[model samples]
Target chain A: MKLDSAGLQILSRHECVALLGSVPIGRIVFTDRALPAVQPVNFVLDAERLVIRTAVGSKLAAAAQDAIVAFEADEFDPGTRTGWSVTVVGSARAVREPEEIEYLAGLPLHAWAPGSRDHYIVVGTEHVTGRRLSSVDVG
Target chain B: MKLDSAGLQILSRHECVALLGSVPIGRIVFTDRALPAVQPVNFVLDAERLVIRTAVGSKLAAAAQDAIVAFEADEFDPGTRTGWSVTVVGSARAVREPEEIEYLAGLPLHAWAPGSRDHYIVVGTEHVTGRRLSSVDVG
Candidate 1:
């Protein structure tokens, strides 16, 4: 409901999660020694949990259990400088249940990073927000 | 040239910067309070400096002086599942110099966030790295 000066529409939580399903790739932001780090990963939404596959012992997998993380995805048309971006901040937990891991493996989650991507991490969408940039700014 | 098992090419510093130039939008990953936050912004790479515009009191603008940040941009085709992503990790500084602000204003840095976007911050690209997910894996 917050529209900035340019009339960029502040998307609702429902809208944010819906948009999350539209894109396959997004950046996952995490902290490394208190400094923010970002990496692009392909993800899938299983109901409300945002699932991603990372390599074993990878920086992402090694993230502290219940670590706070941020996920962002957007589809923009550079030609018109218009698009929608959604950000979800939540707690990340490793999927350790054998049954759950097997289920996630079949969820069509593709890890673009090459290697043994045997780790599954899920970020519960607690705070979802987004903005829509229109081609024509609302003056 | 560290190639991953999937044969994804590890991009060089020079190659990373070159790829960054090809995009007009990127995500500025910052820390809000004690947790990580990821927000998308329009930016322009000035040499090794990544410049972005934000509102005066926004979290991004109020980030700690010399705060470490990460900027990421990428393009992936769904059909081919191929794309490249570049990440620059460095310190962010507010662009306060009148002359500098004026010069940056003239650049094609579009601010999608509605507002005056008067505050400018520059991230010095201290460490630039990238990865290329090729449809053809070398493995």
Candidate 2:
């Protein structure tokens, strides 16, 4: 697979959606203590938004309250040197409605760590974008 | 730049250190309202600990007041089909001492975004780990 700078710059909406739909994990970016941070999380696509779960008294809960956040997911094929990444920027909020929480909880999401998984953070996207890199582009 | 599973595992550690040392950006993972949430942040490596700046109303400050947190960083290179990721898991705390805050402020770190930088969230890492992926492993 080959990619050009122009192609990388102009990602179609369909491509963005595809990337988001195909990948289940991504890095979420937000501000904590006035510093930039990113973390890997398994998310579900809910009504074109990203949803995740965590525990109370977690760092993520503290930093993302009504704040601007960025979520990203990508897949790269090492053999062919091809990969695409999609990022969604939006504000995050804690879901309050019982119905919404129950619906989100039914998703096939699991935390790799052990703790009381009792909190939820939803990133409501304002913008969606993506970029791709490939060996063909270099050639 | 080819790698086997074992090589990928070894590179994960190097990737972790590199991710932590290369920049002031990291991600905070925690639970938000019973769901998992992640946000990006700027951090400094202080005495092997990850330090960040936050404010009173900030999420990090609230989370770190008394809870376990996860901080992470990584760099992915699609060209060589190789990349590394690092994560630090530990407890976070607020730096109240004037001397410590002043010393941290002197570090060569800058916000990747624009905003009024305040407060500080420091994650004292009790564990650090990383991982890599390659075609061979996937195949």
Candidate 3:
């Protein structure tokens, strides 16, 4: 990994996906009513794609079907003011196949929101970008 | 202060603004080359608006001026599988006035990313919605 003068390291696609898998929660951003809306969801990855479980009637499920979306996850230390943030922008496709839904249900992913979370939204890993802040603001 | 049967509480605008003030880090989601992009920034609240200090040449500074954007912040507890998230969708107005810029620079807000952070992006609180999970997952 090459670190910039400011100690911000740019992460590759592989590294970004690996970090995504370790985190269970991330924010999914989509256009709702022509405005950007963000919601946090617990996700499990099928390779580099993000699989989110949500209620069929929820706004997230409604907006994610075959629409362009962005998923973001970050970890920061408030004490040190340093952390890594990864963002993935892709198409949110709805999983309609019964077999795939069953397979995803078997995964450890659980919806934190209280509701009948039966809808699955998949976002492909097409555009990925990430940056990690160093211990200090390096110049 | 409305609490649902599922233990999901609707936070009041005042409560939401208070929670935003308590956190120092959040994500700013904006359009980058017609695609949604998210970046983590340390923010300070100016009343109900989000103030982010960023580099002049950064994508955030470039895309934020007079643009529709979303700012999100949340806190979650993994052990309990519960958390609260607040998202704000509004227009980002660049702080261009020399006096206003100087005033904002004096505020405690500091840029975590390394660079000459000489720009300020402010997002108003016109659209604010937040949901908090109760102690138990009430169904």
Which numbered prediction scores highest in TM-score against the true structure? 3
Error of 2 at A51 (Å): 0.5
True contacts kept of 3: 0.49
Q: Say which docking band candidate 3 falls in.
A: medium
Per-residue lDDT of model 2, residues A42-65, tens digit only: 577777778877667666777878
In candidate 3, the residue pairs with backbone N, CA or C atoms under 3 Å apart (3 or more residues apart, or in different chains) clash, namely none
Q: What DockQ values do the models have? A: 0.54, 0.05, 0.55
Deviation from native of the Cα of residue B47 in model 3, angstroms: 2.4
* Distance from true location, Cα of A11 in model 2, Å: 2.4
Give the distance in Å from residue A111's predicted Cα in candidate 3 to where it truly belongs.
Answer: 1.1
What's model 3's overall lDDT? 0.84
- Flag the better candidate by TM-score, 1 or 3: 3
Error of 1 at A68 (Å): 0.6
- Residues B46-107, model 1: lDDT tens digits: 86789888888877787635788888989888777789988888888988889999998888
TM-scores for all predictions: 0.92, 0.52, 0.94
TM-score computed on alpha carbons, candidate 2: 0.52
lDDT by residue (B62-98, candidate 2, tens digit) is 6666466777777654344445568777777777788
* Candidate 2 local lDDT, residue A135: 31
Q: lDDT at A62 for candidate 3?
A: 84
Model 3 C-alpha lDDT per residue in residues A21-134, reported as the tens digit of each score: 878899999888888788888888886788998887777888988989999998898878788888989999999999999998888887777767788999998888888886
